[model samples]
Target: MPRRARKYAVRTTYATNAALALVLAGALTACTGSSGSDGGEDGKAGDSSASPTAAEPGKYRTLPKPCDVVSVGTLREMLPGAAAEDDGTAAPSAGASPYEGEPTATYDTDRRVGCRWKNATSLSTRHLNIDFERVVSYDPAVSDDEQAERLYAKKARKAGIPLDPDDTSPDADSEPDPGSEPDSGSKSSGSPKTDSSKKDGEKGSGHKGGTSPDGHTSPSGAPDASSSPEDDVTDSPSATPGEDLAPRSLDDLGDAAYIDDELHTADSGLHRDITLVFRTANVIATVEYEQWVTDKHRIPDSQELQERARELAAQLAEQFED
Candidate 1:
């Protein structure tokens, strides 16, 4: 072979090898760059993971049966009329079962349940109802207790009871609308003209008919003692704060609580409804007691019924602690 041709072939081989080396280096650089970028992204993800931490779970996930929470003793006292026939008769009358509670219908027992009792005697008709709700928050941002607190706040407002001004719970995150704001100018459906428990906050059942202790609603500021519940000791507000038996927030019953009293005259007679609502952890409980007497001259005693309702509420609150 000629020396020039051999030299040319060797140079070509060297150039080809150099080109291959450059290509391998470029590929290696790309791989290293991609691996480094992927590692940086993974590190960033790990650093921000704690910022979106999930909210804590609620205290209670299951609710007890509503009918079972309230016992027969409460029913007996609340429904005294049921015992009226028992005293004279040797055997149980084939009448409405008074002590056997009627459970409210609901699709979900774990989430909500209620029991209602109604007893009618010749003198007065008594009604008792208990409701239990186990609140749940689908959003990961909120908890069950917080959701329950909000629900209780809403219930208080609907009943015309004011939210506690000093409530520091998460539900109190924003100031509640004033409950004193005149009710939508009209009474709610089937709701009669009621004297709010807050109505006598400063006066115990204060005079409603122009400083007169009668159950008349004097719209003209004129004293109309000739009301249906006239001359009754349980008339309107105008007394001392000690008798402020109107609808008001309760601080002692549970995590939060309130009571509502309403009096309205019906053809059967004048009836008074006393209701209590309380919250514990993630559960909300309600105790509503009603007394209806055929006599219009006498109204249900707020203090008496309120005391009983509060007692029952406290009992139910203790149950949720378990």
Candidate 2:
């Protein structure tokens, strides 16, 4: 009786031990599988949770003070009649110079700055101004340079200068070289006669004694007493043989550049204003040269003013480069 009972008890114990082993193995396999899945999910996080791209920063971090940028010598040239320490033979020493350019008011110096200067005397009245802009792009995809380019495009459009000089689009005002012809209504084979040009031509130094600046036909047709033979050529450059001075784009100045020459009558007298604009990297520079002549018959030369303005623009661009 005892042997049989013993045998049954041993079999029951063996069965219980086997059941426990199977349960433990199953639990271990589940833990290993869960750990592997967690590792796979963590490996893919780099692809799904990565940071997005952002725009590049502008090249220029800050802008220079506008009034202090130019030298005394440059100011004297730009604003004629400006008092000088000497008779214009040599540049005044820095820090000791009397010419302190007038700075224009600005809300943010980092974004924009400007300067203006003026000279008035018995001979004539003249003005000069310079401005600088630093563009910054907030968009993630756009860069500072791109922002400046877009702004320059807007300015060029407003300036009314044809980007493509040879452009033949009907909307374009400039005519090509070969096809360009003087208007039939013109006085001669020269620039076409617009009422404004015709009147300005009379006032120009072209005649030994320039006509009156009032746009009126002189009653006496007499030469202006103030006129001299030297006044004949108004520093004007012909856009074309038959064309008036039109605002135009310049290729050699900077990333992009343009010049505008205009003559209009003001209350004081005839005034000539020349504007030159250029872009470089994240910066844009503008130069404005203006002259008001008391002598009604003396019209300021457009080419001369334009050249002076252009030279100033180049200097500003170089400053940014430095």
Top candidate, metric lDDT: 1
Residue pairs with backbone atoms closer than 3 Å in model 2 (clashes): 191-242, 205-232, 235-301, 235-303
lDDT of 2 by residue, 159-239 (tens): 556675453223212311121222221011111112334233322222222222224332112222232233222433322
My TM-score estimates for the predictions, one after another, are 0.69, 0.61
The candidate that achieves the highest TM-score relative to the unseen native structure: 1
Taken over the whole model, the C-alpha lDDT of each candidate is: 0.62, 0.59
lDDT of 1 at 163: 81
| Candidate 1, 114-150: lDDT as tens digits | 7877655544556677877667765566666776787
**Any runs in candidate 2 off by more than 4 Å, and if so which?**
1-51, 84-98, 164-245
**Regions of model 1 farther than 4 Å from truth:** 1-33, 36-51, 86-96, 166-243
Q: What is the C-alpha RMSD of each candidate to the true structure, in Å?
A: 8.7, 12.3
Q: Mark the 10 consecutive residues where model 1 has the least summed lDDT.
A: 181-190
lDDT of 2: 0.59
